[model samples]
Target: MPKSPRKRALSSPHDALFQWTFSQREHAVGLLKAALPSSLAAAVRWSTLRVEKGSFVDRALRSRHSDLVLSARIGEGRVYFYVIVEQQRDVEALMVFRMGLYMMRLWEQIVRDQPGLKKLPPIMPVLIHHSDTGWTAARAFQDVVAVDGPERAALLPHVPCFELRLIDVSGGRAGDLVEQALTALGKVVLWCLSVSGDDARLEREIARTAAALDEVLQAPNGLAALEALLRYLVATHARFSVRKIGRLLEKAAGPRAQEAIVTTLDEIERRGERRGRAQGERRGRAQGRAQTLLELLTARFGAVPAEVSARILAANEAALVAWTTRVLTAPTPEDVLVEDGKRPAPARRPAARKRARRS
Candidate 1:
């Protein structure tokens, strides 16, 4: 019997992988067209699509959903479409509410940035859900609310209403996505996301996936797409190691595909090592600076107090340097330890009491 696939971790890598893949203009446009309603998709002028900076979600909520804001011409109007790429394992009950919040934030940012513009660009929100289970949550804010019928009708004009153009990839057909996608890159990415984390499904689709990747490899900017796809594959699969995936690629698409996969892996390893070394060097420098500051304080003040020594050790490189510079002119230990632009409190000495007889 085939071994069961290991459960993958729910993390930012999935969100990051999707963001990277869809950051490409062509891929983003293809995704919007494939996932959006036929009427909205038809209105988008693909050639005018541009990926914008800043996510709709605040920093804290970004891990749960990766956002992509793309501006495009829709029926002669320039509109922003916020794509919330959700990779959570379970469905969020308040997804519609969250979408409304994201849309409002996007609008706020637009107003803040372009103060002179009298009219704000309309936003079309899209939610692309990729989880093990299909999304069953309400797609409109009104649907999730308590009020309904007559009461809902009375409050409809007062309350915010927005609907998400949802694309549920869980249990979706790869053939459907492939047929819908405009570019080979889009097709392969959509197919990969649809079957990710299922070793059995991945194994079954290996040949088709390899063929799609090979087609992407031949196109312009193919190398980047290949690297992104390889990274996504490694990220999503728990059963297959990078080496195992590379071997699978070799078997499916020959040595060239395998070589590309291996090269990308090697490059990632090299970058990681370099980053590690750089961080280590930074920490070493900070420690050395802290030690030097401690020594300078000891030399100037003679035997630093426990509290001061602890502060010195805890201080970062910048703080250590600042204190070390102050040691040259500061009269007291307190003065030397004091932060820049702040005066140390003056020491108070009790005056000598006059003799009772003399008074």
Candidate 2:
């Protein structure tokens, strides 16, 4: 029998998002360099990360391993960057707490190793969210505590990292970058940037990416790799179009080569299209469920605050759809903020008892 997929340690609704991010390391690194135009970004030439976990217990505790860690060239020296990319499709409020533990571990590891070296490279915490629910406030909890009032004050010495919400990148923006070659790293960064648009623009961008992919595939000795990438893109693109795929195939490879490439692309597209449609249906159900939960909240609490409602409404389609079930099923608003069952909140409390004892 075929073996089951490996179970991730931290399974949240954004599990797919996390998995997607880790798998695209090249794309992740490209994004890091592009987003931050600092010394680390500029000084770096190439990047990669050590992803293995040793068997020793101490290694597990002391090591500052991230889902995706990148090492970049900084002129004469190399700087290592850690990214804790969380997918907050349905769990927005919880990151307020998670950022603390993640940042602490990284900082602690950096501090412990400082005596050996004159200075340590900068470490960054990046939260990339596809869902709208988590972007309720400008700052995640990690961003708040690091600040020592509005005036200048050195509280933590190191700056707390910022969060990037993919849901904010719109279709128009996706169109702007679609024509660009974006290295594998660029693709990963673009994924986050693509989070803001509607299905049509998303489809257009996917087509553009597919076209670019065709170029890569047509590259000498790149057929196999390009085919694999196309398969992945088809699976991920929610509104994949067969005609677009066919046209791209024809354009990338003339009539003679089209047969072979088209055949493979077609098979993958058919399978992926089916899967994508099912995913869309599931998202629809989730949205409906979330709406019902919101109704319940309104009945019980006299409507969720306008700010909260606006944020929730502003959530991107992918995230809003994914979290529908979570919002409806979750026990409390706080629960809605958490990914999966893990929470930063203390133990749940019993509701107040109505008093009518002997008086």
- Give lDDT tens digits, candidate 2, residues 1-359: 11111222122212333334344555455456544545545566655343322111123422222244555556676565544443333444555345556555655666676667666665554544444433454444445553456532555545454553222233224321222334542453345334432345544455445444544445453444444434434434446565564565456445555666666666665766787898899777666755765676676556576554654555556555455556657676545545555754555579999988896
Off by over 4 Å in 2: 1-29, 45-66, 73-78, 84-97, 106-121, 132-136, 139-143, 146-181, 188-199, 237-260, 266-359
lDDT of 2: 0.47
Top TM-score prediction, candidate number? 1
Model 1 C-alpha lDDT versus the unseen true structure: 0.74
**Candidate 1 per-residue lDDT over residues 84-166, each given as its tens digit:** 87766789999899888888898899989989878878988888787776887898888888886678788888877788887
- Clashing residue pairs in candidate 1 are none
Clashing pairs in 2: 27-184, 27-185, 92-134, 169-196, 286-324
Model 1 residue 141 CA deviation (Å) reads 1.2
Q: Could you tell me how far off, in angstroms, the CA of residue 37 lies in candidate 2 after the best superposition? A: 1.3
* lDDT per model vs. reference: 0.74, 0.47
Error of 2 at 139 (Å): 4.7
Which run of 10 residues does model 1 get worst, by summed lDDT?
A: 1-10
